[model samples]
Target chain A: MRKIVQIVLAAALLVPAAAWAQQKGGVVIRSVSEVEVKQKNAEGKEEVKRVDATKTKVLPGETVIFTNYYTYSGDKPATNVVIKNPVPDHMIYLDGTAAGAGTRIEFSADKGKTFGTAGKVTVRSADGKERRAAAADYTNIRWTLEKPLNKGAKGSVTFRAKVK
Target chain B: MNTRTASIIVGLLLCLVTALAAPQGAAAATAACTGIGNTASVAYSVAGAAQTPVSSNTNTITVGNKVDVVVTTTDASPGPAVVPNQVDVLLHYTITNNGNANQRYQLSAVDLATGVTTSVFVGNQTVTDAVLVSAGTATTGDNAGAALATTATVAAGGTLNVTIKATMAAPPLTDGAYDVFALRARSLKVDGTTLEANGSSTIDSAAGTCTADVVLGDGAGTDDAVAGASPDGSHSARSAFHVVLNNLSVSKSSAPYNDPINGTTSPKAIPGATMEYTVVISNPGGSSATAVTVTDILAGTLTPVTGTPTWSSTNGGNVPCTNQAVANIASGGWACVGTGWAGSTLTATIPTLLSGETATILYQATIN
Candidate 1:
C-alpha cells in the first residue's frame, strides 16, 4: 500500500509538469487584419501590397482579410488540429476566401450547431423555412489540418469579410 | 365616379407605401461607432489525448462613418408652368441618406452652373434664389411648413422631402422663359454644430474602440459636383420654373358706311362721310389674360354717332356675333366688359378673357 501511494503521487506530479510544459510551448494563435494598398513600386509599376489594417481607416463596404497565424512549439506532435472563427458582428464572409494549406474548410450557418462544406450548409430563416446557405449566411468557419502538426510547425489560415 | 376615385386613391397609397418602405439605393452599411471584433480558437490533441482549447486575443476595428447621400429632383423636367409675374411656384426634391448614420443637412438652392444650359422654348431665367420648405405631404400643398434652410435628422436609409418656393422673379419674363436651379444639401453632424468632414480631410486613423470618421461616398450628381473630397460632402439635384404665358393681340379695322358723294358704291374717304369701325382682341394661349384695355384716339375729323356701339364675345367658338346697343350695355350680363365713348375717343376693357377667346367692339363714326 505504501509503494502504490508513492507511485500515484509521482504520476500526479508528472501530469501537472507535462501540462505546464504544454502550456508553455503548445499551439499559439494570433489574429491579424490585412488591408490591400496600391502604391508605385521602384519601377514605377502599380502594385498592391497587404498592410496591417490597424494603421488605416476601416469603413463599411470594404473588404478586410482576417488571418489567424498558428505555431506548435510543443515537444510532441499535435493531432486533429482544428481552428474555429466566427464571422464578426456587422461583417459578412466572402465566398472563396476561406483558405489554408493542407486543410479542409467547413462553415456553420446555425452558429456552430452544425457544419458542412460550402454548398451543403443549410440555414433556417425567421420564417421557419430552410434554404441553402449563401456566403452571407455563414456564421462560423472551421479549418481542419489533414496531417499532424510537427513540433516547431507554423502555418496561417485566412478568410475575407466585408463590413456591412 | 366614386369607384374610379377609390381606385386612384388606392394607386396613390400604394406608391406612398413603396416610397416609404425602401430607400433608393444599396449604400446601407453597419452603423458608425459600432465595434466589430472577433477572437479565434483552436483545439488539438497530443499523443492521442485531448488538450484544453486555446483562444487567441480578440482583434477588433471600429467601423467609421460613411457619409453619403443622393439628391434628386422629384419634379418632372421643366417643371410646373409658371405664368409671368406669378409668385409662389413650387418645385420638389428628395434627399436620401445613404450613409451609416443619421444626418441633418444645411439646404440651399442656386442656378445650375459650370456653363451647363437647360432648355426648350429657351428664354432667360429670372429667379436666382429659392426659399426651401419642408414638404408636409406628398403633394406640394401650397409649399407647406416654414421656410427652412436646414432639415431635421434624416435616419440612415431614409429620405426627406423638400420643396422650393420661389417667385417668377424679375417679371416680364419672355414667353417660355425658364430658370434652372440646383438644390444642394450639405451634411451637418448629429450634434448640430460641427460640419461633417469629407474623406480627404486629415483625421485620426487609429482603428480600435469605435473611432468614427467620415468617408465621402456620393457620386457627382446633376449639379456637376466633383467625385473627390472636400466639395463631395454636399450633393445637389436639379429643378426649374418654366414660363407659360398668354398670347394676346389686338387690331382695328375701318370701313365706309356711306359717303356724301357716292352712297354705298366703292365709297372713298370724304368730308362728312359716315364710317364704321370694329376693334378686336384675341388670346390664343393655354392661359387666360386679365384686365386688358384697348384705346383708340380719333383726333381731328372723327365724330361719334349716338347709340350705335355694340360688342360681343365668342370665347374661342365661331358663334354668330350677337350685338347689343350701347344703351343696353347695363343689361348685357357682362358687367366686367365695357366700352366708353367721350367725343370721338373710344376705350374698351375686358376682364378675364379666357384661353382661345375673342372679343369685338363695333361702332359708327362720322368724318367731319
Candidate 2:
C-alpha cells in the first residue's frame, strides 16, 4: 500500500512538469540597455566652449568668413555630404571651394527659412516699393563637393559673404 | 471482517473515480492551447520589379546659360504612407564656352517609352527639365543647333540648377519593399565638338526602400449615393455663374453744372484712356444666395466717377446710378451700399450682393 501511494504521487508530479515544459515552448527573456543621448557644440567640440560673440557679430554690409573642416571616419568613402547653414539676418551668403572636388553652390531667398531650387526663389517688390526680391536675392548658399572625402582624411571649404 | 471489507471497497471506488477525472482534466488543459505556432513560417511577400534607368538626359543653353535638372523616384503607391514616398535629386549645370567660337545646342526631353520628344528651351536660355516616369525608360536632349537650342559663348559659363521629384503612385506597398529607377544625362554636340558620350552618374538607385500597409474600410458609397437623410428631404445642388461687363465709358470730362468740382484731378491717366472692363463674379451656393457686388475701389491715382453708374438690363439693382455717400469697405468685406463709405470705402459699396446678377459700376480716376 505504501509503495502504491508513492507511485501515484510521483506520476501526478511528472504530469504537471511535462505540461509546463510543453506550454513554455523555450521562450528566453532578453536583457536590453537604454541608449543615452549626447549633445555637442556646433564647432564639433565635445566640451562646453564659449564662443566670443564679438568675433562672430557681423554688421550690415560687412563681410564674414567661415571655414568648415569635414573628416570621414567610416570605411567607405563619403561622396555627398550636405552642409547647410542658415543665413542670419542682415547678412548674405557666398560660394565655397574645396581642393580636389569641384563645388556647386546655391542660395535661398526666404531668409534661411526655406531652401529651394534657384528658379523657385522669387523676389518681388514688397508693396511695389522699388526694392526687388528675386531668386537672385539669396540668403543661404550651399556647395556640393565633386570628389568623395576618404576615410580618416579631412577636407575644408572656405566661404566669404557680405552683410546685407 | 465486515469493517475491513467495507473500507477496501470504498478505497477501490475512490481510486476509479480519480482515474476517470485525471484524464478529463488533461484533455481540458490541452484544449486550451492558443500558441502562435510559428511566425517565421508565415512569410510576407512583395512584388519585386526593376525599373529602367534614365539615359541621355540633356540640357542646352547659350554660351553663358545655366540649367537645373531634378531627378525624382516614385514608388508604385500613389497615396501617402508611413514610409518615404519620394526622393529628390538636384543637378546644377552650366554650358561653358570652351571652344574658339559660340555654339548652340537644342534641348529636349524624350519619353523613353513613346519616343515622343518635347523641346524645353525658354526664350534664348536653356530651361531645366523635370522628368517623371514610372518603371520605364527616360532621357533628355541637348545640342541641336541655332534652332531652339541653348546658345553660349566659348568663354562664358551659364549657370543652371535642376530639381527632380519622384512621387510614388497610389496603393500602399508592404514594408521592406523597393522600386528601382535610373537617370541618364548626356550633352548634345554642336559645331566640331562631339557630344560627350560619357553620361552623368546615376542620380539614385535602389538603396534604402521601405513601405507601409494601409487598410481602407467601407463607408458610404463614393459615387452619387446619398450619405444620409436630408432634414428637408431635398437633394443638394451646386451651381456657378460668371458675368462680364463690356463697352462702359470712363473719362475726365467736365463736371456737371449742378455739381461742384471739390475733388482734385489725379496725375495718372485712366487705363486704356476709356475705362472699359469686363467684370466676373463666381458664386458657390449653399443655404444663402452668395452676394455678388462690383465696386470701383481705387486710391491715390484712381478716383471714382462723380455720378451714378448705368447698368445693363441684366444688371442687379444693388449698384445705384447716382454718387451716394461714401462708405468703408472692410479689407475683405462686401461693398458698403448706404452710409459706410465715409472713411476708406470711397468709390465702393459695403453691402453683400445676392447671387445671379450682373452689376456694372463705372468709375473714373486720375493718377496722383
Candidate 3:
C-alpha cells in the first residue's frame, strides 16, 4: 500500500495541476536542453551533433541550449501568449540568443520585476552606478507571440546559456 | 496586434528543486557533483479568459571534478651547509591540492642523476591542533627528524610540508661537493597508493543526475609532470645539498730587501742582507673559522728586524672579513733555544677568518 501511494505521489508531482491542461484543446508546453558536440559525418566532414544535456557530462564553461516547445490545441484561436524563463543558477544568459518566430523578445535584469528590449535593459554596478546590462546580468527572458495561434499550431523558442 | 484583446500577464511560478544544484566554487573549481537544474513556465489566454499557467519538466546537468596539484621547494636561503662526513642535510618542500575534491598524494625524493631514493628520513612528524606527533622509526638514511611518510591525504585547497634528509659520504666528498635531489609527488586513489588517472567516460550512461567525472588539470612542474598528456598528474622540484669544509689555506714567500749589492730591487738572499717575508692566510670555502693564529720563527743566520708586522684584509665570495692587523700583535720574536739558523719565533693572532677572505702579514729579517 505504501509503495502504491509513493508511485501515485511521484506521478502527481511530475504533472502540473492546471485545469486547462486536463481539458481538451489546451496548450501544452515542454522544456528541454542540449549541447552541441563536434563529430565527423559520413563524408568525413566535421559536423555539430546535438547531445541531450541532461544525459551527458556538462562541465563548467560549456554552453547549453535551452528550448521551449509549445502546441495550441484549442477549438478557437488563442491570443496574448507570453512565456518567461529565469536563468538557471550558476549559468549566464547569452546575448541575442533568445529567439522565436513571430514573437517579440524582452529581457529582465532585476529578476523579472520589469522587462525591456535587450539593448534598453540596465543593471546597477557594484560602485553604485547604473549601466547597460551585459549578457551575464540578464535574469529572465520573455517571449510574446505576435500572432494568434489556432488549433494544432506548434512552435518553439530557444536561448543559449553558458555554465559558470 | 490580434483581434482578441484579452491580456492578463499571468505569473505562474513553479518551484522545482534539483539536488546538488547549489552555487559553488566562488573562486575555484565547482564541486564535482553539483547539479544545475532549470525549469521554464508558460501562460496564455483562450479568446478572452486567462487560464492557469503551466511549467515544464526540470532538466539538470552535473559538473565534473578537475584534478590538479602543485609542489614547490620552500627551503630557506643559503640552503643547508654540511661538512665532510656530516649526516642529515635537510631540504624542505610543500605540496598543495588544487582540485575540487579531497585527494591523497604519494611523495618521495630521489637522486637527480641515478634516480635512486637514498634520502629516506626517520622520526617524521605531523602537527595538528597545536599538538605534535611523530612517526618515530629509524631507517638506513641519516635522519634530522624530517617527515618520512610516503603518502598523505589532504582536503581540497589544503597543503602539506615534507622534509628530505641526506647524509654526506666521507670518502667521496671534497671541500665543495654538491648533490642534487628531486622531490616528486603524484596524486593517488582511495587505497593501496594507486596513481590517479584521467577519466575518459564522457557519457556516464546516467551522466546528468549529480554524478561527477575526473579530468587531469595540473601543468608540468620541473620535468616531473608528463608533457604529452593534456595536463600532468604529478609535480616535482629539485633541491641540492652542499658540502663546505675546506676553508683554511696558508701561503708564504720571502724577498731580499736593503742588501749591499741590491737595495730593495733585483736583490737575492745574500749574507748581511735583509729579507721581507709575507705570509698569506686565506679561507676558500663557504664557512667561517674563528680564533685563528699564525706562528713563525726567525733565528741564527736570520735576525728579526721587525718593528711591527703589517696585515691587510680582503672580503670576497661567501666570506665576510675585516682587517684586524692592528689587533694582531706578533709575540715571541727573535726567541731561540740552543740552535743555529733558528729564525726569530713570531706568532700573529687573528680574531675571525671568513670564507673567500685573505689576510696578508709582512715582516723584515736580516741574514748574517
Candidate 4:
C-alpha cells in the first residue's frame, strides 16, 4: 500500500511537469502595438479618406505607404523575428529605412525562393545593361535582427514606392 | 516495507503515470479552441465627383461657309473630386458655296459639336452678290432649286448679317446634364477644274467647308447659363475687321476717246485735255467680309463711275469726277440719263465687322 501511494504521487508530479514543458514549447504571439499607415497627395493632403486595408479595393498605380512599428513582449528572446512583406502586384518597393537597431534587411527577387543583398542585386535591361535593382523590384523584403530580440524591444521599418 | 523498496516503487509508478499523462495532455492541448466572438468595424467617409456640363452642335455644314457652336461644362461638386476631370468631344461639318465666284474660308468655335452657322452678306440680304453665304440643309450646293439667296451683293469689303438658331429636338435634357454638338464648314469648287480634260461644263460645283465649336451652359433654368457648370468656365473676346482691295480703272482725254470702261483699260491721254474719275463703297452690316475685287467695263461714250469705288464710313458719298467726255458712253449704259443704262459692279472685303459698324466706297468720273 505504501509503495502504491508513493508511486501515485510521483506520477502526478511527473504528469504536471511534462504538461508544463509542452506548454512552454508552444509559441504564443500577440500584437503589442497597433499598426498604422498613412498616405498623402501631391497637395500634401492626407488620402486616408476611403481606405479600408482589410477590404478596400485598391486601383492600379495607387500607393499606400505603411509606417508600422512592432514590439516583442514574450518571455524568451524571439529568434527569426522576420518581417515578411509581400510586394503588391501594382506597387514597386521603394525603401526600407530603419527606425531602430537590432533589424537586418534582405530582399527576394524570385518570389521568396532566395534572398540577396538589397543594394547589390543586378537587373539586366532589355539593352543588355546591368543595373542595381531597388528593393521595390523584389517580390518581398525581410528584416532579420542581428540578435534575438528581448522582451519589450520595439523597432520599425518604412517603405515607399510608386504604383507601377 | 523497507525505505529503499518504497522509494523504487514510487519512482516506477511515477514514471508510468507521467508517460501516460504526457501524451493525454499534449492531445488535449492539440484540440483547437472554440469560442463565440464578435468583431465590429466602423468607418467614416466623404464621396464626391466632378460634374461638367458639356454642350456642342451637330455636323454637316455648307461649302464656303462656317458655323459656331459652344460646349460648356461645370464641376458639379462643391468640393473637388478625384484628379483628371476633363471632357473631350468632336465637331463634324460640311461647307458649300453655290455662287459663281471663288470664296476664301475660316472657322472658329469653342466646342466641335455646336452647329452655330455664320456668314457675311450685303447687309441683311440673300447671297446673290459675290460674298460668302451660309449653306443650310434647306439651301446647299449650286442647285438654285435648293439654296436660298442672299438679299444683297457681296462687295469686296462689304459685310453681311446672319442669325444662328439652335433647335433642340424633344426629350429635354436634365437640368445639369451636358449636351454636346458639332459644326463644320469648307470651300467647294468643280472637281475637274484642275484637270486638262475638256470636262462637260456644269453649274453644279463641289463646295469647300470649315467649322467652329462652342461650349455653353445648359439652357435649362435650373443651371446657370453664363457661369458654366463650374466656377472656372469664363472667356473674353474682341471684334475687328481686316480689308484688302484690287483696283480696275480706265481713262480718256478727248471727245472721240469716249468708250465705256471695260475690265481692260488703256491709259491714253488726249493732247489738250485731262480727265479723272473715282468710285466709292461701304459696308453697312454686322460681321467681317472678305475677298474684295473691282472690275471696270466701258461700252460707249458715257463715262460710268470712274476708277474703283473708295472706302467710306458714311452711307452716301459722291465719287470724284474725271475730265473725260460722256458722249461715248453706251446708249443703255448711262446711269442717270437713260432707262437702258447698264450699271457696273465693284467689290471689296471687310473680313469682319462688329455690330453697328460699317465700311464704304465711292466712285466718280469727269469729261472735259
lDDT by residue (tens digit), candidate 4, A47-105: 64533222332222234444335555544444545554545444466665423356666
- Tens-digit lDDT string for candidate 1 (B130-243): 333343333322232222354455677778766666555443555555666666777776566566775432222122223466777766665533434444767877776666
Winner on DockQ between 1 and 2 is: 1
Question: Alpha-carbon error at B136 in model 3, in Å?
Answer: 7.1
Distance from true position, residue B194, model 2, in Å? 75
Docking category for candidate 1? acceptable
Q: Number of clashing pairs, model 2?
A: 61
Alpha carbon deviation, residue A117, candidate 1 (Å):
0.8
Off by over 4 Å in 4: A1-52, A55-82, A96-101, A108-119, A135-138, A149-164, B1-268, B271-368
Model 1 steric clash pairs? A164-B30
Give the TM-scores of the predictions, in the order they appear: 0.67, 0.19, 0.61, 0.30
Q: Where does candidate 2 stray beyond 4 Å? A: A1-60, A94-101, A111-121, A124-136, B1-368
TM-score of the first chain alone, every candidate: 0.85, 0.46, 0.83, 0.54
Q: Alpha-carbon error at B68 in model 4, in Å?
A: 30
- Per-model C-alpha RMSD: 11.3, 39.3, 18.4, 34.1
Would you list the C-alpha lDDT of every candidate in the order shown? 0.65, 0.27, 0.61, 0.28
**Ten contiguous residues minimizing lDDT sum, candidate 4 chain B:** B6-15
Q: Give DockQ for candidates 1 onward, in order.
A: 0.33, 0.01, 0.29, 0.03
